[model samples]
Target: MAQADVEVVEDMNVEGGPEAGEAVQVLRRVFGYEAFRGSQQEIIEHVIGGGDAVVLMPTGGGKSLCYQIPALVRGGVGVVVSPLIALMQDQVDALRALGVRAGFLNSTQDIEERRLVEAEFLAGELDLLYLAPERLRVEQTLSLLDRGKISLFAIDEAHCVAQWGHDFRPDYLALSMLHERWPEVPRIALTATATEATHTEITTRLRMAEARHFVASFDRPNIQYRIAAKNEPKRQLLELLREEHAGDAGIIYCLSRASVEKTAQFLVENGIAAVPYHAGLDPRTRAEHQARFLREDGLVVVATIAFGMGIDKPDVRFVAHLDLPKSVEGYYQETGRAGRDGQPSTAWLAYGLQDVVQQRKLIDGSEGDDAHRRRLSAHLDAMLALCETVECRRVRLLAYFGQESGACGNCDTCLAPPQTWDATVPAQKLLSTVVRLQRERGQKFGAGQIIDILLGKKTAKVIQFDHDALSVFGIGADLREAEWRGVVRQLLAQGLLAVEGDYGTLVLTEASGGVLRGDRQVPMRREPEKAARAARAKAKRAPVDLPEEALPVFEALRDWRGRTAKEQGVPAYVIFHDATLREIAVLRPASLDGLGGINGVGENKLAKYGQPILEVLAGRGTTDGGDAAGAGSGSDHAPPEPPDDIEEPPDDIDW
Candidate 1:
């Protein structure tokens, strides 16, 4: 914060045996970033000084710089082992643009390309070389070592060393070779997610046994968590798209290939810019979809869990799931993708009973032993508990990962708040219907048929089963079928209603004991499914086909950003992100202070561009928020946040 405090923070550094002033300068020059982010400066000094380290920084915490700066300042090339090809390319390209010597070896590279990279490596002309762990153990890789010097072996995504990690890679196991072959080379392992176990596992696996651990704060204050019951998940997701996510950068995750395609198509038909991606798709098609989502603004990509392992897109506004994730860690990592740029964003999920059933079925179908199955079930149970919680989701999520957070009042539970109603009767009716249908037809009926029987419907299946003869028949006639479905889904989430996937039968697990015995009064929303969906639909405002009154304002801001970026020689984002731009456009901040209050602007930036921006805001000079006149003292004073409006973008555009 202050100069003296910064010095104090850096003063606590440890060293293996090296100087680091040149490294700091390299950092400032190439990245235009003034200083290293927390523990980074010290971590760099430690690595360059010659000890291995493990860094646990949040996403967007600038972990890459901790290694990159030291690599350039030190005597030899930095060998960075990474898992994601996309992440590697993005990092390398960004480094190369900054005039740094960085290259990577991936499946995408031709043999000559690999040879050339290795040649540069031997010549000692490369500052850093990215390696996929899978290729790091081969003879060719070992041969490169004789010709090239390794200053440090940096392992990114170090959490992959843990079996519980969402992005676990088998290749990560080979990292022990780095320690075996080059015991002299310092290793730095970095990850955004690592509980106590994961952290311990990384160091143990890499044999960086004595690594100085630097664990930064795990606070992502900008992201909000919201979970809704799986009531018409499709429509709920659509509501999310139109509301906060309309024309915004975001990702929606589903559990299946069919759901992925269907969701993407549904979103596209509903007028959102969306596409589906999964392992089942052709690689080229998947790559194209990913590229399009990355390069373009306002694109929403719906995909299976396979997507976005190491995507570097910075402005994702929200992350929504149409189905339940396999584990809480999976959900956390995926949802963490939102608000990465330190702006407020949302993580919304609409889940239901079938998702839980499907997830359990998949886990059971796997070749794992009973112990392994129990492990999977434990993770799933935790996730379902999170979904069922009326308490703060963020607190529970962080708590699961061994971090503590107080009530944040930022999640849905802290906002509207859930009010649970006694559902004893509904629960008994649901169980009885399942039992009656299974007994009569010699098989369990799906949710629809069960709901029909409960409501006295004479559908072909229900009539054939003669389920109305059951004691619980017509007992739930007052509740709409969808409401009953919601009840059933919630029961499944609680592990009270279990499905036999192979036979498609409703087999109550032992966990269902309380619900059947009326010992558990299931808490449920009393609202009918159709009415609930309608309420959600109404809550989300339709996107302004073109909010035209704000059009000129947005164009002017973009122009200002470009001109400022050119003069300052920084990327447009270093000035302001698209979200900030959109807000500026929408609000049309009448004063420099008002502009600063819009999120990205701060006091220091105000002094530099305040007047020019204010002049533009006042509609003066060539463009308003633009100024031919130099900045003045008067422009230093700013106002409050601009009020909201149902305005439109201008017809004439500049883009």
Candidate 2:
């Protein structure tokens, strides 16, 4: 059949193409799923009918399939505009494993590689082609696309196009040209995180305002969200990992490069395998660290926000934040990285008064204009509200995206409801201290000195300033230092108190007048006591939901998968996700036909690995003898050791 005629038939007739139900057929024959999830089937049909769409789904919600199935059902090569150059190879490898002819063009490719992919694309042999968004600037690339038989455009991580978003990429600003140039070709923009404002921004910036919008619920019920007061956070993180997530694949996000290094080193010293990632590292070192995290099991990656945007690893068991995120969108995006395989996981964060002070200081010192600073403060304010709320975290989180949901019963607030006390008196006392210092002494002080004076403790700094002699010195003695700090934090969150200067000195906002005049009530969330916290920690360490006899079979299948992944030099999940393996072990499929019916076992995979999977299930393959509880879901084998003297490369190297 000629290419034009084939394209016309596929585009016009969904029921009577070469085969009926082509999208479903591709889903089963290639990606291996029985039914489409959520709005996936509707989105696929719309795109296959040559219509544009804006898709808002949570991470691991199968956004890829929304575009992939359409690309397979429609004619020509589907051009994917992706920002993750480093991960393109893994994506293509995964597609090729499913027997799809996939390729990518990026700066990482050599002249020969680029020519080969270009030739394949021009010949209409490539089913899908991935391109970095920046490549569209090159005339050669635009001309190249014009010569090829083009399918729909798939824009992944579409939130980056929003100028005010947490993960904005300047290269994405030019993406609207895709619609302008290819007026007839359909386009689909997909993102895992976006607020209502960001959603509108994406639509406006991408010129997709007329496209149908599909917004899915942003709840990941399998992930238990927990945020606690940051008491010695490094030690707290260590305890959490030791008790609940030992030997599990996880990501620990820090706010700075220095913190990333310290956290990784801390984990390594505590006998946990870990690697550090940040933009400051050389490109090669970053790539190698990313490769290790993807290929090995039970490896922890300590990183800044630079990591985890396009990471496809499905078995990450936890995501911990030692520092507070700047915004709710960022927090959701980072935490969404965990439990991609739909297994139970933890999204733990250690927050404290210092986090708020530090974030405020950053905004003050930031280079943006007044309007930009206001935007930044708005983001921080929403995040603080989430941390301080006594209600369900999941409900608050989903509501930020304009999706209303009831209490999830799984978050920290719902599982152990916190006591909300009338802190109006404490709030007045703290604000009074600030006023006395500013009016009488003509001075400003940080939270430490203020707390010392409130508690009437004659510490060195207090005595140095003669703060012990103040009129309100001992009035707050009824509250402990921690309780006073909580009052201060709550006041800051309420905007009655503000942090100023590099030292984060306390100052009063316009809202402080009502509190001082007894016209406003301040309610504060009481932090969970030590015993309650310990109980929750213990509960999180419970075993995975699997039958006793199936544990060994699961371990054996993981062993086989690890070995196969190593043989192919791809990530273990690329062969088959842990969720898929868990089901296989539970069902113990005895025949090839039965194995093919599993969720992730596509035709190519069933024909290739089905027999070996059965062998592992039947006890023919070698199994690791260690207790499955100790090893968790990752492989028992350790990855290779990284070099000790890794250094930053020259400036010319492309990262």
Off by over 4 Å in 2: 1-20, 530-543, 620-655
Model 1: lowest-lDDT 10 consecutive positions = 645-654
Model 1: what TM-score? 0.79
Where is model 1 more than 4 Å wrong at Cα?
Answer: 1-24, 432-443, 518-655
Q: Write the per-residue lDDT of candidate 1 for residues 1-655, one digit (tens) a residue.
A: 0111111122222232234476665654454333454688899889989988999876656677778878988899998887767556545644554567888887788999988988999999899998888777688888887578988988887888886666677889888888878888888898877777778888888888788999876767777777777767888788777765567778888877898899999988999889888877777777677666644556788887777655545567788988888788788878877755455677888877677767778877977689878878888888988987767787898887778889886666665566678887888878867766666657666677777877888777666766666676677898877677778777877777886767445677786767778777778654323433443443343233214444455556667766775575433444554445565656666776566555434444455666776666456222343432323324322221111100011111111
Candidate 2 residue-wise lDDT, 379-432, digit = tens: 999999999999999999998888889998777888788889999998899899
lDDT of 1 at 102: 86
Model 2 vs. true fold: TM: 0.91
- Name the weakest run of 10 consecutive residues (lDDT summed) in model 2: 643-652
